[model samples]
Target: MKRKINCETARNFSIVKALEKLGHFPKKSNEKEAWFLSPFRSETQASFKVSKTKNRWYDHGEGIGGNVIDLVCKVLTCSIKEALSFLNGDTLFFSFQQQQNLLKKETGIDIIKVQEIEHPALIQYLNSRGISVSIANTYCKEVWYLYKASEFFTIGLKNDKGGWELRNKIFKNSSSPKSYTYIQNNNKQLIILEGMFDLLSFAIMEDVLLNTSDILVLNSISFIKDIEKFIHKYIIVHLYLDNDSAGKKATQYLMNKYEHVIDKSSSYRNYKDLNDVLSYENRKEI
Candidate 1:
């Protein structure tokens, strides 16, 4: 029989619990109200509020609000059915347990049992991506996998999914379609990039230049909407979007709508992205 979905079942999957799952916590809580750091933007202040009685959330910074499901949908960027399936712990859809078990049996290795990384190959993979070994170590971990009864290792980025976005040595692959690194300073300025490699390349090039600017990598251009509110909040936004036609279109679209956002594409007009520029001789030295 097809089970029914209801608001009661949905509300049981609390917005508070979902935010907590995403490493966000309420700054203050009482019987009625819960205050939290804005999950939509990088902010030290607690601007996101939840009414426990109503099971509703409001982001004062972004001026967005709704029920618990709305919060989950926004955070995961998934549809109502997807969010419901996730909340229900549906084994067929987005089950982390199933994925972990599958990863374990296929690799003949337990992912959780894998010890601390001391792998040089993983380090080299980060280096190839223009990410320094130290920076990679700060944000990611080396993971050993058993796939098809073969043992292999990959560099994995910790994601909201609680799954590692694995980048294998042979293919340079990522498990998630979204592969962007995010960094926020004091939240006054914002810098946006397209991909992980481009973000790393930009970091290498503008390490000293980016002091207080928050960095966001879109992973995919589709995630751009996720950060739109943040873009509106900040005073200055430096868009280092890719040099490709799609990138140009996105940049132009954003520039037309946003007054504070600046297109920094003139500098990389000849290259496809930051990594392409960084790959050349004498480019790495800069």
Candidate 2:
């Protein structure tokens, strides 16, 4: 058991805002009720309900309901004691609200500068993942942006849809109007990857093969439905995705929808993903 010093405060804190941090923004909401997709599981329909009047939540899918503390425990997979410690520390709560407010107040990602990928720190970071400078330079640009009044730089991969997928050692974020990166040439064959790093890993492994077809890097799985129409245009579609539950679900989703869709995760079956596979291979070679 743990002390209840912050229990009451944590209980009454905005569950809505907290859920937003968990990427569970409500699909529909009124003064009393907010409904969202069950963040705990993969589902198309929204089943998670948040009651502002009661300041509690019920994931109808999970058949369970509780206050903010309970929700945090479930999200973090931690104990009530651990949850309380986390809440008292005020990391998630304060940080989330601050970030949310910043988004509302600011215009969007403010590009301070765009440069070549020559920063030694960034190069070292890429080297660890088996991505060479030349390969990264071809597809990625070094971008410095301001978010929430803090200046940061990352390797930015511009998507076809006029937004950037930003990444670095400390942070991972995509610019507004998120969409997949499509390296298109031939529409006959399509290679679908979950993230930019995976796409980069694939490019490094098989650069010649990459040019032979179009590549679609989802950037985030939220764009899965958005890319349905585009995927149909390709005669052959190869999926290289993470082996986790969401990835497995996405793989199955594509398989059921399209006849040509193929899961190519066998190469990295033992590892987490393509990047993992590439890094491990590089280590073995050394």
TM-score of every model versus the real structure = 0.53, 0.65
Residue pairs of candidate 1 with colliding backbone atoms: 107-146, 107-147
Best-fitting candidate, scored by lDDT: 2
**Candidate lDDT (C-alpha), each:** 0.64, 0.75
lDDT of 1 at 239: 91
Q: After superposition, which runs of candidate 1 have C-alpha atoms over 4 Å from their true positions?
A: 1-118, 128-130, 146-150, 160-164, 176-181, 282-286
Model 2 C-alpha lDDT per residue in residues 1-286, reported as the tens digit of each score: 6555476667777889877654456778999999976655434457789999998899865468989888877675557776676555444432222222122112576888888998776887788788998999988998877765786677889887777876664335567666778787965998999887898899988778788988888887666888888887888899998877667888999899889999998878998789988998888888
Q: Which ten residues in a row have the lowest lDDT in candidate 2?
A: 97-106
Runs of candidate 2 with Cα error greater than 4 angstroms are 1-107, 148-150
- RMSD, every candidate, angstroms: 13.8, 6.6
